[model samples]
Target: MQSSFSPLVAISPIDGRYQKQVNELSGYFSEFGLIRYRVRVEIEYFILLAEKGIFKMPAKIKPAQLRAIYEEMSEADAQQIKETEKTTNHDVKAVEYFIKDQLHQLGGDEVAEWVHFGLTSQDVNNTAIPLLWKEAVEESFMPYLLNLIATVKEMARTWKKIPMLAKTHGQPASPTTLGKEIMVFVERLQNQIDLFGYVPYAAKFGGATGNFNAHQVTFPKHDWVAFGNEFVNERLGLQRMQFTTQIEHYDNLAAHFDTLKRINTILIDFCRDIWTYVSMEYFKQKTKKGEVGSSAMPHKVNPIDFENAEGNLGVANALYEHLSAKLPISRLQRDLTDSTVLRNIGVPMAHSFIALKSIEKGLGKLLLNETKINADLENNWAVVAEAIQTILRRVKFPQPYEALKDLTRGQEGITQKSLHKFIDGLDVADKIKNELKAISPQNYTGVEFDY
Candidate 1:
């Protein structure tokens, strides 16, 4: 039976309203995707066994033919496995049966018994889940994030010379370049992205209970430990966990979730900052034809993209927190909890992917309002007090901070004339007074960065 599930009827927004943005993720995290990965693991393990001479394969059976079982896996194949699961009441076992049925069709029934030999469900699951996750991160997630960072960097470079008032505790405090402010997020995101390398894409391939008891009892002479390592590390390109329970220990997996959560948190911060900038009119959005930002308000152009990104990032962070906290703690050796939780690994990923796309779109639409930015600088002359006071301090002037504070603090209508008047009254050299007059909010920004 074909899936009648359409986006219109889907429950989650990731699958419904935002499905188009995240459709590519289904290939990595969907039920069919999971089943396909299981098939791949089973076939590869069987081929490894054959290469090790653990079983005599028919001379006619080619490795390519075995590999095609998974490479050519279709929705029909996944559905057949699901049907088998109904009878077996076990998902991994259904995959094994499906592979055996394929081998039977290929005139290699003799080797079919060796498929998934001496392995429990965790052996396939622990390896497959992490392997697929590794692929998804490298292939999809990292690319999107890198692209977003590049966009941010480009914007930063463009506005590197643009001065804007800085706010601390929601009040104008100092002056900073727009580029430097944007670059802050770039450095923060890159720092966390680099940490991904430290947390390994770890997997467990040991047989039931973290030891190869079945393999050892059947063939005590074979080095099953080395076999497990080579299969998981070399063949699958995943870091093999040497010691584990029936399930993977999941500490490394938790680390991955935490790292992802931190990344999302940074994105959330970026979204809010961008939204605030939009509200401040430092940035204007390019209005689309026939698109309404607000139904009732005609002149409004809302920062919906950043708003969407923030909301999605919030949802993604919540899921990441649960996944990170829950996956590491299980009942003694193993339990069913990680199995269900592991399946949801893709849920937060899909949300994060959507948020990334939203952020990219939001960034692309930003039109820097240089007039507004400059006007803001011009209006907030009080910010220059810091520069004047700091220079006064450098000159060993008495009560520099107090003097500047008295002139600017809570005093309304402080303008160029008023500040210049105060500067002329200072008991300092003409050069010092001239220096103070030159320091406006626009030029009060600190040293230029190489951004």
Candidate 2:
């Protein structure tokens, strides 16, 4: 420990530069947090044993004394466990010892023997980690995602009717409402987020090889499998895998990371699109009084927030990819690879948290350049060719597509007059010709949606 902690010396930005912004994650992901959760699982398991009648409580011991083991955990309690870990060289064993010591202190030495009875370290690690992850997602990630979605939704509503030039293959095509374009991303995000809801936050609770071999061996009459399912599902609020090795299969956890990867991919796409819009003058950022975009280029009001978002999201997705690929595969019963990898799970999450903040900040700074958006639409009158060609099709006009293709395609700066002149030559009835003549790039966006 330093005399004064500082971000300057921290290795990862998650614990350093961005610490303040992501401090809320500490209660679920930090070292002390891990120890705290481990203690919770141990205490709960001890209590569960009694409730299930697998362990009879000592006469002098009260249930409240057991509950206080975790409810009253503190920095000193976690530090004591850390001190015990040095001697045991096993994290879960250290927690077991700490809980046993606590039970002794409560004058329940008779009941202390049941602290971690018939369980391996994975029993604690798998349950504690998933429980921690569950809370982190529910408490931290989902809110950020929902808030971002809502903010974008509000932007869509505010700009619903504002027409902008659409691009296909980097060339002007038909026009689209800015809101509709924004909604494209909103729909993509919501679709994935909806699917994310179905991917279970699963855990493995079987003793050593996912079969409750030790549990069944010790208590031949007890339905250990049923007990595990009920405890993991009802008590811990997580899905219990029916079969496993020494570790969880991690298939569901991988799916969760994959879902997060999809989300980050969508967000990266958004950041880049927004950045491009800023470069194209379709957006102006609200600049602060003394903030600098460039060291030398003084006039620039850069889209740094979006850029920040893109970078962090890319980093997050990279880590998430690794997690998805590596966590699900292990040798035979189990290996140590998943052990070290699981510990760093919070790193990717931290990156994602950072990315969401950047995106929110970027979105807040956006000021739509209506004049530029309209000018883009006005200048690309050739975009109306789609509407004209479609209307021409309705009138049974031959060669309408070729006619417009010849008149506008590859012709730089085709104006409204040029389109109207082409409409005048059409063999359609007067009413239909007039309809075609009235269309312009600014008014050519197809059927508006309520969103």
Query: Which residue runs does candidate 2 get wrong by more than 4 Å?
Result: 1-4
Tens digit per residue, CA lDDT, model 1, 1-451 = 2366898988998889998898888888999988988888888899899889899999898999999988988888999999999999999999999999988888998888899999999999998999899999999999989988998999899999999989999988799999999999999999999998788999988899989999999999999999999899988999899889898888998999999999999999999999999999999999999999899999999999999989999999999999999998989888798888899999999999999999999988999999998887778888889888899998899999999889999887888888899899999999999989988888888889896
lDDT by residue (38-113, candidate 2, tens digit) is 8888888888999899978877777777778777778888889889989999999999999888888877778787
Ten-residue stretch with the least lDDT total in model 1: 1-10
Models 1 onward score TM values of 0.98, 0.97
Model 2 scores a C-alpha lDDT of 0.88
Clashes, model 1: 0
